[model samples]
Target: MPSIPLPGFQPPESIQEVFLNPGGFHFGTTDTRIVTLLGSCVSITLWHPRLRVGGMCHFMLPSRGVIPEGAGYDGRYGDEAMKLFLGHIMRIGAEPEAFQAKLFGGANMFADMAQRCEINVGERNIEMGLLQLERYGIPLVAKHLGGESHRKLMFDVWSGDVWLKSEQGRKPR
Candidate 1:
Protein backbone atom coordinates (compact mmCIF):
# COMPACT_ATOMS: atom_id res chain seq x y z
CA MET A 1 0.00 0.00 0.00
CA PRO A 2 1.10 3.57 -0.73
CA SER A 3 0.36 6.60 1.38
CA ILE A 4 -1.10 9.71 -0.25
CA PRO A 5 -0.85 13.14 1.36
CA LEU A 6 -4.00 15.23 1.52
CA PRO A 7 -3.87 18.75 0.12
CA GLY A 8 -4.81 22.03 1.77
CA PHE A 9 -4.81 20.54 5.24
CA GLN A 10 -3.18 21.62 8.47
CA PRO A 11 -3.22 19.85 11.81
CA PRO A 12 -4.69 21.54 14.82
CA GLU A 13 -2.26 23.13 17.25
CA SER A 14 -3.42 20.73 19.97
CA ILE A 15 -6.46 18.76 20.92
CA GLN A 16 -7.80 18.39 24.45
CA GLU A 17 -10.88 16.32 25.18
CA VAL A 18 -13.09 17.30 28.11
CA PHE A 19 -16.27 15.68 29.34
CA LEU A 20 -18.60 18.07 31.10
CA ASN A 21 -20.38 15.56 33.29
CA PRO A 22 -23.76 16.32 34.79
CA GLY A 23 -22.09 18.99 36.87
CA GLY A 24 -18.72 20.04 35.53
CA PHE A 25 -16.99 23.24 34.39
CA HIS A 26 -13.62 24.19 32.90
CA PHE A 27 -11.74 27.24 31.60
CA GLY A 28 -9.03 27.50 28.97
CA THR A 29 -6.56 30.01 27.53
CA THR A 30 -5.53 30.82 23.97
CA ASP A 31 -2.95 28.04 24.08
CA THR A 32 -5.46 25.56 25.50
CA ARG A 33 -8.54 24.14 23.79
CA ILE A 34 -11.87 23.09 25.32
CA VAL A 35 -14.43 20.54 24.17
CA THR A 36 -17.72 19.33 25.62
CA LEU A 37 -20.59 16.92 25.02
CA LEU A 38 -23.86 18.30 26.24
CA GLY A 39 -27.43 17.19 26.84
CA SER A 40 -29.62 19.10 29.23
CA CYS A 41 -26.71 21.13 30.53
CA VAL A 42 -25.67 24.51 29.23
CA SER A 43 -22.26 25.68 27.98
CA ILE A 44 -21.16 29.29 27.79
CA THR A 45 -18.19 30.67 25.83
CA LEU A 46 -16.60 33.98 26.80
CA TRP A 47 -14.07 35.66 24.54
CA HIS A 48 -11.97 38.82 24.62
CA PRO A 49 -10.97 40.43 21.30
CA ARG A 50 -7.91 42.45 22.28
CA LEU A 51 -6.21 39.55 24.05
CA ARG A 52 -7.59 36.86 21.71
CA VAL A 53 -8.33 34.74 24.78
CA GLY A 54 -11.43 32.82 25.80
CA GLY A 55 -12.91 30.08 27.96
CA MET A 56 -15.93 27.80 28.19
CA CYS A 57 -17.81 26.13 31.02
CA HIS A 58 -20.54 23.48 30.96
CA PHE A 59 -22.91 23.60 33.88
CA MET A 60 -25.74 21.26 34.86
CA LEU A 61 -27.39 23.31 37.54
CA PRO A 62 -28.62 26.87 37.29
CA SER A 63 -27.46 28.02 40.73
CA ARG A 64 -24.82 26.78 43.15
CA GLY A 65 -26.93 27.35 46.27
CA VAL A 66 -29.58 25.06 44.83
CA ILE A 67 -27.21 22.20 45.39
CA PRO A 68 -26.95 21.33 49.09
CA GLU A 69 -23.29 20.39 48.80
CA GLY A 70 -22.39 23.86 47.50
CA ALA A 71 -20.55 23.83 44.15
CA GLY A 72 -17.82 21.87 45.98
CA TYR A 73 -14.26 22.28 44.74
CA ASP A 74 -15.26 21.93 41.06
CA GLY A 75 -17.65 24.88 40.87
CA ARG A 76 -19.98 22.96 38.54
CA TYR A 77 -22.99 25.19 38.92
CA GLY A 78 -23.68 27.78 36.19
CA ASP A 79 -23.22 30.84 38.42
CA GLU A 80 -19.96 29.63 39.86
CA ALA A 81 -18.74 28.45 36.48
CA MET A 82 -19.32 31.88 34.97
CA LYS A 83 -17.36 33.58 37.73
CA LEU A 84 -14.50 31.13 37.42
CA PHE A 85 -14.38 31.43 33.65
CA LEU A 86 -14.31 35.21 33.82
CA GLY A 87 -11.57 35.16 36.42
CA HIS A 88 -9.52 32.82 34.26
CA ILE A 89 -9.78 35.04 31.16
CA MET A 90 -8.85 38.12 33.18
CA ARG A 91 -5.87 36.32 34.62
CA ILE A 92 -4.69 35.66 31.07
CA GLY A 93 -4.62 39.39 30.25
CA ALA A 94 -8.13 39.49 28.82
CA GLU A 95 -10.19 42.53 29.74
CA PRO A 96 -13.51 41.74 31.36
CA GLU A 97 -15.13 44.88 30.01
CA ALA A 98 -14.22 43.96 26.45
CA PHE A 99 -15.45 40.38 26.55
CA GLN A 100 -18.26 38.90 24.47
CA ALA A 101 -20.25 35.75 25.07
CA LYS A 102 -21.96 32.91 23.23
CA LEU A 103 -24.14 30.16 24.70
CA PHE A 104 -24.99 26.65 23.57
CA GLY A 105 -26.55 23.35 24.73
CA GLY A 106 -29.48 23.32 27.19
CA ALA A 107 -31.49 20.85 25.16
CA ASN A 108 -34.71 19.33 26.38
CA MET A 109 -33.71 15.85 25.41
CA PHE A 110 -35.49 14.39 28.40
CA ALA A 111 -38.89 15.88 28.01
CA ASP A 112 -40.14 13.54 30.71
CA MET A 113 -38.10 15.48 33.25
CA ALA A 114 -39.96 18.67 32.49
CA GLN A 115 -43.09 17.47 34.30
CA ARG A 116 -41.18 17.30 37.58
CA CYS A 117 -40.52 21.05 37.78
CA GLU A 118 -42.32 24.26 36.97
CA ILE A 119 -39.48 25.09 34.55
CA ASN A 120 -37.42 22.49 32.76
CA VAL A 121 -33.85 22.05 33.92
CA GLY A 122 -32.61 22.69 30.39
CA GLU A 123 -34.54 25.94 30.22
CA ARG A 124 -33.32 26.98 33.63
CA ASN A 125 -29.76 26.31 32.59
CA ILE A 126 -30.12 28.58 29.55
CA GLU A 127 -31.80 31.27 31.61
CA MET A 128 -29.12 31.15 34.26
CA GLY A 129 -26.35 31.22 31.67
CA LEU A 130 -27.79 34.35 30.08
CA LEU A 131 -28.33 35.91 33.48
CA GLN A 132 -24.73 35.29 34.44
CA LEU A 133 -23.49 36.90 31.22
CA GLU A 134 -25.73 39.89 31.84
CA ARG A 135 -24.60 40.20 35.44
CA TYR A 136 -21.00 40.31 34.29
CA GLY A 137 -21.92 42.88 31.64
CA ILE A 138 -20.69 40.64 28.83
CA PRO A 139 -22.49 41.03 25.54
CA LEU A 140 -23.92 37.80 24.14
CA VAL A 141 -23.22 37.81 20.42
CA ALA A 142 -24.39 34.36 19.39
CA LYS A 143 -26.20 31.27 20.59
CA HIS A 144 -27.42 27.88 19.37
CA LEU A 145 -29.40 26.65 22.32
CA GLY A 146 -32.57 24.73 23.24
CA GLY A 147 -34.45 21.99 21.35
CA GLU A 148 -34.34 18.23 22.02
CA SER A 149 -30.96 16.99 20.93
CA HIS A 150 -27.52 16.51 22.38
CA ARG A 151 -24.56 18.55 21.11
CA LYS A 152 -20.80 18.35 20.94
CA LEU A 153 -18.92 21.65 21.07
CA MET A 154 -15.33 22.45 20.20
CA PHE A 155 -13.93 25.89 20.96
CA ASP A 156 -10.78 27.50 19.59
CA VAL A 157 -9.62 30.24 21.92
CA TRP A 158 -7.30 32.02 19.53
CA SER A 159 -9.90 32.25 16.79
CA GLY A 160 -12.91 32.50 19.08
CA ASP A 161 -14.79 30.10 16.83
CA VAL A 162 -17.21 27.64 18.40
CA TRP A 163 -18.05 24.54 16.40
CA LEU A 164 -21.20 22.67 17.40
CA LYS A 165 -22.00 19.15 16.26
CA SER A 166 -25.32 17.46 16.71
CA GLU A 167 -27.22 14.61 15.11
CA GLN A 168 -29.00 17.02 12.84
CA GLY A 169 -25.96 18.91 11.56
CA ARG A 170 -22.88 20.98 12.38
CA LYS A 171 -22.87 24.73 13.03
CA PRO A 172 -19.71 26.81 13.00
CA ARG A 173 -19.45 30.31 14.39
Candidate 2:
Protein backbone atom coordinates (compact mmCIF):
# COMPACT_ATOMS: atom_id res chain seq x y z
CA MET A 1 0.00 0.00 0.00
CA PRO A 2 1.22 3.48 -0.75
CA SER A 3 1.80 5.51 2.42
CA ILE A 4 -0.56 8.41 2.91
CA PRO A 5 0.45 11.15 5.28
CA LEU A 6 -1.59 11.39 8.46
CA PRO A 7 -3.09 14.73 9.44
CA GLY A 8 -1.78 14.85 13.00
CA PHE A 9 1.49 13.05 12.68
CA GLN A 10 4.63 15.06 13.28
CA PRO A 11 7.22 15.29 10.59
CA PRO A 12 10.02 12.69 10.75
CA GLU A 13 12.58 15.17 12.05
CA SER A 14 10.36 16.69 14.70
CA ILE A 15 9.00 14.96 17.76
CA GLN A 16 10.73 12.56 20.15
CA GLU A 17 8.72 9.49 21.15
CA VAL A 18 8.78 6.29 23.19
CA PHE A 19 8.00 3.36 20.96
CA LEU A 20 6.45 0.17 22.33
CA ASN A 21 7.30 -3.08 20.65
CA PRO A 22 4.90 -6.01 20.40
CA GLY A 23 4.34 -7.83 23.72
CA GLY A 24 5.22 -4.67 25.61
CA PHE A 25 2.94 -2.46 27.70
CA HIS A 26 3.12 0.82 29.61
CA PHE A 27 1.02 2.77 32.08
CA GLY A 28 1.45 6.17 33.62
CA THR A 29 0.02 9.62 34.14
CA THR A 30 -0.63 12.15 31.37
CA ASP A 31 3.08 12.83 31.22
CA THR A 32 3.64 9.84 29.02
CA ARG A 33 3.32 9.70 25.25
CA ILE A 34 3.96 6.32 23.70
CA VAL A 35 3.88 5.05 20.15
CA THR A 36 3.74 1.71 18.37
CA LEU A 37 3.35 0.30 14.88
CA LEU A 38 0.93 -2.51 14.28
CA GLY A 39 -0.24 -4.91 11.60
CA SER A 40 -2.49 -7.90 12.28
CA CYS A 41 -1.89 -7.09 15.94
CA VAL A 42 -4.01 -5.31 18.52
CA SER A 43 -3.36 -2.59 21.07
CA ILE A 44 -5.64 -1.46 23.87
CA THR A 45 -5.49 1.86 25.70
CA LEU A 46 -7.16 2.34 29.05
CA TRP A 47 -7.49 5.52 30.99
CA HIS A 48 -9.21 6.75 34.12
CA PRO A 49 -10.27 10.35 34.06
CA ARG A 50 -10.68 10.76 37.81
CA LEU A 51 -7.31 9.27 38.58
CA ARG A 52 -5.67 10.78 35.51
CA VAL A 53 -3.94 7.46 34.94
CA GLY A 54 -3.77 5.36 31.82
CA GLY A 55 -2.19 2.32 30.13
CA MET A 56 -1.41 0.89 26.70
CA CYS A 57 -0.50 -2.61 25.51
CA HIS A 58 0.75 -3.94 22.19
CA PHE A 59 -0.21 -7.56 21.77
CA MET A 60 0.73 -9.88 18.90
CA LEU A 61 -1.65 -12.84 19.24
CA PRO A 62 -5.13 -13.34 20.58
CA SER A 63 -3.97 -16.03 23.03
CA ARG A 64 -0.87 -17.74 24.34
CA GLY A 65 -2.09 -21.10 23.05
CA VAL A 66 -1.06 -20.18 19.53
CA ILE A 67 2.55 -19.71 20.56
CA PRO A 68 5.11 -22.50 20.74
CA GLU A 69 6.09 -24.39 23.90
CA GLY A 70 8.22 -22.70 26.53
CA ALA A 71 6.52 -19.43 25.68
CA GLY A 72 5.06 -18.35 28.98
CA TYR A 73 1.88 -16.31 29.23
CA ASP A 74 2.96 -12.81 28.37
CA GLY A 75 1.86 -9.39 27.14
CA ARG A 76 1.98 -10.60 23.53
CA TYR A 77 -1.36 -12.31 24.05
CA GLY A 78 -4.56 -10.28 24.48
CA ASP A 79 -5.77 -12.18 27.56
CA GLU A 80 -2.47 -11.96 29.41
CA ALA A 81 -1.82 -8.39 28.37
CA MET A 82 -5.27 -7.32 29.51
CA LYS A 83 -4.63 -8.83 32.89
CA LEU A 84 -1.26 -7.19 33.25
CA PHE A 85 -2.51 -3.85 31.98
CA LEU A 86 -5.49 -3.76 34.29
CA GLY A 87 -3.39 -4.91 37.20
CA HIS A 88 -0.88 -2.13 36.73
CA ILE A 89 -3.46 0.61 36.43
CA MET A 90 -5.41 -0.78 39.37
CA ARG A 91 -2.31 -0.61 41.53
CA ILE A 92 -2.38 3.13 40.97
CA GLY A 93 -6.01 3.23 42.15
CA ALA A 94 -8.01 2.90 38.95
CA GLU A 95 -11.36 1.14 39.14
CA PRO A 96 -12.81 -1.04 36.44
CA GLU A 97 -15.84 1.12 35.77
CA ALA A 98 -13.77 4.27 35.79
CA PHE A 99 -11.83 3.19 32.78
CA GLN A 100 -12.61 4.23 29.22
CA ALA A 101 -11.05 2.10 26.52
CA LYS A 102 -9.93 2.82 22.97
CA LEU A 103 -8.77 -0.07 20.81
CA PHE A 104 -6.48 0.04 17.75
CA GLY A 105 -4.16 -1.98 15.53
CA GLY A 106 -5.97 -4.89 13.95
CA ALA A 107 -5.16 -4.81 10.26
CA ASN A 108 -4.93 -7.74 7.88
CA MET A 109 -1.68 -6.60 6.30
CA PHE A 110 -0.63 -9.67 4.41
CA ALA A 111 -2.68 -11.66 1.94
CA ASP A 112 -0.47 -14.74 2.15
CA MET A 113 -0.61 -14.90 5.90
CA ALA A 114 -4.35 -14.45 5.88
CA GLN A 115 -4.72 -17.25 3.36
CA ARG A 116 -2.52 -19.60 5.36
CA CYS A 117 -4.08 -18.88 8.72
CA GLU A 118 -7.66 -19.12 7.42
CA ILE A 119 -8.67 -16.85 10.28
CA ASN A 120 -7.98 -13.16 10.49
CA VAL A 121 -5.84 -12.47 13.52
CA GLY A 122 -7.10 -8.91 13.50
CA GLU A 123 -10.73 -10.00 13.73
CA ARG A 124 -9.96 -12.49 16.48
CA ASN A 125 -8.18 -9.75 18.38
CA ILE A 126 -11.17 -7.45 18.14
CA GLU A 127 -13.44 -10.22 19.40
CA MET A 128 -11.15 -11.11 22.27
CA GLY A 129 -10.82 -7.49 23.35
CA LEU A 130 -14.55 -6.87 23.22
CA LEU A 131 -15.28 -10.09 25.13
CA GLN A 132 -12.76 -9.29 27.81
CA LEU A 133 -14.03 -5.73 28.17
CA GLU A 134 -17.59 -7.00 28.41
CA ARG A 135 -16.53 -9.52 31.03
CA TYR A 136 -15.19 -6.70 33.19
CA GLY A 137 -18.01 -4.34 32.33
CA ILE A 138 -15.53 -1.77 31.16
CA PRO A 139 -16.83 0.59 28.52
CA LEU A 140 -15.09 0.82 25.18
CA VAL A 141 -15.05 4.41 24.00
CA ALA A 142 -13.61 3.97 20.51
CA LYS A 143 -11.88 1.56 18.16
CA HIS A 144 -10.02 1.33 14.83
CA LEU A 145 -9.85 -2.24 13.70
CA GLY A 146 -9.96 -4.84 10.89
CA GLY A 147 -8.58 -3.24 7.76
CA GLU A 148 -5.84 -3.69 5.14
CA SER A 149 -3.38 -1.11 6.45
CA HIS A 150 -0.97 -1.04 9.32
CA ARG A 151 -1.66 1.48 12.07
CA LYS A 152 0.49 3.87 13.98
CA LEU A 153 -0.87 4.13 17.50
CA MET A 154 -0.22 6.81 20.09
CA PHE A 155 -1.29 6.98 23.70
CA ASP A 156 -1.28 9.98 25.99
CA VAL A 157 -1.08 8.49 29.46
CA TRP A 158 -2.20 11.50 31.44
CA SER A 159 -5.51 11.84 29.65
CA GLY A 160 -5.82 8.15 28.91
CA ASP A 161 -6.55 8.95 25.30
CA VAL A 162 -5.19 7.53 22.06
CA TRP A 163 -4.95 8.55 18.41
CA LEU A 164 -4.51 6.45 15.31
CA LYS A 165 -3.08 6.86 11.82
CA SER A 166 -2.71 4.45 8.93
CA GLU A 167 -1.17 4.48 5.50
CA GLN A 168 -4.60 5.57 4.33
CA GLY A 169 -4.75 8.38 6.88
CA ARG A 170 -8.18 7.27 8.03
CA LYS A 171 -9.40 8.63 11.33
CA PRO A 172 -11.35 6.68 13.93
CA ARG A 173 -15.12 6.75 13.94
Structural RMSD, model 1: 5.6
Model 1 segments more than 4 A misplaced: 1-19, 66-73, 169-173
Q: How does model 1 fare in lDDT?
A: 0.73
**Model 1 over residues 106-143: C-alpha lDDT tens digits?**
88877776877556788888999989888878899899
For lDDT, the strongest prediction is 2
Q: TM-score of predicted model 1?
A: 0.78
lDDT by residue (tens digit), candidate 2, 41-87: 88888888767667788888888666567765588889888888777
Q: Would you estimate the TM-scores of all the predictions?
A: 0.78, 0.80
